[model samples]
Target chain A: MHRSYYTLIASLPHLPLHFELDRTPITRPRLNERLKLLEDADRDVIDQMSAFLVWDRQPLDRNDQEVIERYDNLMRTVSNPLVRALINTRINMRTIVSAVRRRKAGGSPPVGVGQWVDHIRRNWEHPEFRLAGRYAWIRPFQNLIDEGAAREAQRLLFSVNYRTWSRMAEHYAFSFEGLILYLARWEIIDRWTSQDANAGQQRFEKLISETLGEHANLY
Target chain B: MDESLLMILGWTGIYGATALGAVGSIIGCSRAGQAACGAMLDVESGYGRLVGLSALPSSQIIYGIVVTMTLRGNPLTAQSAPGLFAVGVLCGIALLFSAAFQGACCASAIHASKNKPEVFGLSAAPAAIVEGFAVFAFIFALVVAGGIPQ
Candidate 1:
C-alpha cells in the first residue's frame, strides 16, 4: 500500500506541448478548458481568479481587495513548497505595489501583506525568509519600488520566480514534485505572456539557457 | 569426513550458489520490470529502452552460474570438498547482494527516465556500475577455484 501511494504521488498528469496559449485575450470558456489540465490544488487557485472581477458594491469594495483575499487563501492552502514560494514572491510584489500606491495617497499599509512585508524588512536574512524564494531578489525588488517602476518590478519578480522554478527542476528532476510545479507555473505564465508569443518564446529560451548554464557549474 | 559426505558437501556448494543466483535474478528483474511498466504510462515511445535496462540485474545470475560450474571438479575428494563449499557459498552471497542492489538502481533509473526520457542512458550508469561488482566476484571465484586441489 505504501509503495502504491508513492507511485500515485510520482505519476504526474500529461501536459501536451500544443497547449494553444496563442489565443490572446483568452475567453472564459477557453481559460476554463485549459485549466482542466491542472491538478486540483493548482486548479482551485486559477478558478478563483474570476472572483477578482467584482464590479458590484458588496462585501468587497474593490477588485484589488478581492484579489488580495484570494491570494491569502492560495498562500494558506497550496501544498507544493515550490508553488508556495512562487506565490509568496508574487504576494511580495503585490505588497510593494500596494505600499507605493498607499504612500501616494497618504494612507497606511494594508493588512496581511503589509505585516508580512514588515516582517521581511526586519528579518530579510533569516532562514525562514528564504522560504518565499525572495531572499535573492528582495533588495533588487526594493530598488525597483524606490525608482517608482512598479511595472518593471513586477516583471523582475516574474523572472526571479521563473529562475526559482528552473532551479527546483534541476535539483529535483528525479521527483514528480518539481515537474508538476514547473508545468503549473508555466501554465500561469503562458496565460500572462500569451499576448506576444514571439517575445514570450525568446524570454523563455533566455531563462532556460541561463539556468542550464548555472547548473553546469554545480554538477 | 567420509567420501560420500564430502561429495554431498561439494555438490551442495555448487547447487547453493546456483540457487542464490536464481533468487537474486528474480528480485532484480521483478523490481526493474515493475518500474518499467509504471514508466510506460508517461511516455509516448521508448518503452523498449526501459524494458531493456531492466534486464541489467540478470547478469548477476550469469556470474553465479559461472562460479557454480567452476567449483565443480572431477572426483569431489575430501581434500577439495571444503574449498568448493567455501568458494561456492561466498561467491553466491556476493552475487545475491550485487543483483539485489543493482535492481534497486535500475528501478530508480526507470522512474527518473519516465519524466525525462532524454536521461534514460545517463540514469542507467549507476546500475551498470553495480553490475561491475558482480563481475568482480565472478572473476575472483574462478581464480580461487583454480587454486583448489582436485
Candidate 2:
C-alpha cells in the first residue's frame, strides 16, 4: 500500500487528507506529479555527483547502478554518527513531516523507535530485499553470501541511513554533499576521468544508465 | 551473664540491620542507574564512547551505611547523649533517603548516556554533583551520630 510515504503527505498541515486517506487507488496524475518531483530530486543528486567526480578527477556515470554501487562502496562515509543518524532515521521513518516544516514547524520523532523501525521496513519492503538488490548490483556474487554478510548489508542500510533508497522514495532526504559522496562510493555514474588519464573521462555510460534506469526495470 | 552474650546479641542485630540497609539502597541504586542510562541513550546513542557505571552504584552504598547507623547505632548512643542522639538520627534518615532518590537521578543520567554515548562523555555531571551534595550531608550526619559517646 506504500502507506508510510503518503501517510506523511496526508498529515501535512494544508495537504489534502485524500493523499493519505480517502481510500482511493492512486491515480496516474498524482503518480506523475510525484515522479516528476522525484526525478527533479534525482537529477540534483546526479549533478552533485557529477561535480564531485569532476572535482576529484574521477570517472562517474549516473545511469549505471553497478558503477553507482561501486563508487558508493568506495566513497563510504559517515557524519554526525549519532544525532545526524538519529535524525536521518527519523526522516526515513516518515517521522519528520517535513524537514523544512520541522525546522519551521516544530517536528519531532513521530511516535517511537520501534515505529521508526516499522516505517523503515514498510518503505524499503525488507532489509533482505534491499540486500538482495545490493547483492544483485555486484555481479558474480552467486554462491549464497554469508548470512552475516547479508545482515551487515542490512545494518549498513541503516548505518548509511539507506540514502540510496532514500532517493527511491518521493522524498529527497539528504544533503548535496551526503548524496554525492554516497553515490560516488557505489560508482553509479557515467563519467570518470579514468583510473588512468590526464583529462580523459572514463565514460561509464553503461554503468549509470543500467543502475538508475534499467535496474528499476529489472525489479 | 558475661558481656560476651550482650556482644553476640548486639553484633547480630547490627548485621541484620545493616543487611536491610544494603538491600534497600541497592534497589534505589538500580533504579537510578537505569534512569540515568535511559536518559543518556535517548540524547546521544553513542554505542561505545562513554563511561559512568561507577556513579550508578555509589549512592546506594552511602544509603546502606546511613541506614545501618540510624537503625542500629543511633539508639545505643541516644541513651548516653539524650537530645543529641535524636537530632543526629533525624538528620541521618533524611540524608539517607535523599541520597537514595538522588542516586535514581544519576542512574537516569547513566541510562541517557548509554543510549546516546555522546552525551557529555561523563554526562549529566551536574546532576551527579548535586546528588553528591546530598551524600555529603548523609556522611556528615553519619559521622556526627557515630560520635555520640555510646
Model 1 scores what on Cα lDDT? 0.63
Error of 1 at B83 (Å): 7.3
Tens-digit lDDT string for candidate 2 (A102-190): 32234332232222334433443232323344333212121112232543332332323334433432232123333333333333221
Please tell me which predicted candidate would have the highest DockQ against the true structure: 1
Best-matching candidate per TM-score: 1
Compared with the true structure, all predictions reach lDDT values of 0.63, 0.38
DockQ of 2: 0.01
What is the C-alpha lDDT profile of model 1 across A15-63, one tens digit per residue?
A: 3233334433334454455445456655554443333212111222245
Error of 1 at A50 (Å): 17
How many residue pairs clash in each candidate at the backbone level?
Answer: 0, 67
